[model samples]
Target: MQLENKVAVVTGASSGMGHAIVELFAREGAKVVAVARRKERLEELVASLADAPGEVAAYPGDVSSREVNEGMIDFAQKTFGGFDVLVNNAGIMDDMSPVGDATDEKYEQVMAVNVYGPLAAMRAAVNAFKASGTKGSIVNVASVGGMRSCAGAVYCASKAALISLTKNTAYMYMADGIRTNCIAPGGI
Candidate 1:
């Protein structure tokens, strides 16, 4: 088990890639905190993984909220006794509207989920890692829209910001053995 004895926080964990990632982590013997807005879905996921080598706990909340982001990390440490991994996977797609057609509200909403949430979580995780003296790891889910103009303007820009944040975090914390990475997936 590559992740044996590790404790991880996985956001967007109610469905899709987040759900799959949580399964993989638990299968590898990591205690995982599955986070999402859908409480019932998170409960179902936890129940389904009942016999895995590790464990999964549900933390239902909106990742767009800074408090929620930080709270999930704290939950990982308190529940599992240690914190080692952070997977920032919660996100939402824009309405495929160009900048000229997008609303201020849409921009704020997308950016809050795609970028700000991860930022706050990363900040909280780094502090936890430093305090615990654990060399932690972080994974940010970016998109090809970040590198290309394939998606709506708001989405593309938000993803681009995440990608940059990932790079900056990796560079800033390398000396502390806190590694960070991002995956720029094209599509499901």
Candidate 2:
């Protein structure tokens, strides 16, 4: 059990990669907090993993809010009696609009979920890691478009910002033994 006894909080955990991560973590014996806005989906995920080696709890909320970001982290610590990893996987995509075609609303919404949410979560996680003296890990799930021009302007920009945030966090928190990294996964 690679994650035996570990406590992890995974955002956007109702579907896709987030969903899979939650399952894998629990299978490996980690206590996982699966967070997503879709209550039914989260409940389903928790129920499906009922017989896993570890435990899973559903936390229904929007990651775009600072409160939700902080709340999930707090919940993990309070519920599992420890905190070890935070996976920031919640995100939204912008329509394939170029810069001239991008709307302020689109940019704001994208940035809120893709960048700001992770930033807030990282801050909260670092504080928790410090208080607990645990060498922690933070995984920010980005898109390959962040490193290239394959995606819409707003989405690319949002993901780029997230990648930068990850690098900065990794450097800043290294001394504290809290590792941070970004994963820019993509598919056709």
Q: Best candidate per TM-score, number?
A: 1
**Model 1: per-residue Cα lDDT over 22-60, one tens digit each:** 999999999999999999999999999999999999999
What tens-digit string does per-residue lDDT give for candidate 2 at 113-144? 99899999999999999998999999999999
Cα lDDT of all candidates, in order? Answer: 0.96, 0.95
- List the candidates' TM-scores in order: 0.99, 0.98
TM-score of 1: 0.99
Per-candidate clash tally: 0, 0
In angstroms, the error of model 1 at 132 is: 0.7
Instruction: Give the lDDT of residue 75 in candidate 2.
Output: 97
The positional error of residue 150 in candidate 2, measured at the CA in angstroms, is 0.6
Write out the backbone clash pairs for model 1: none
Model 1 ranges off by over 4 Å:
none
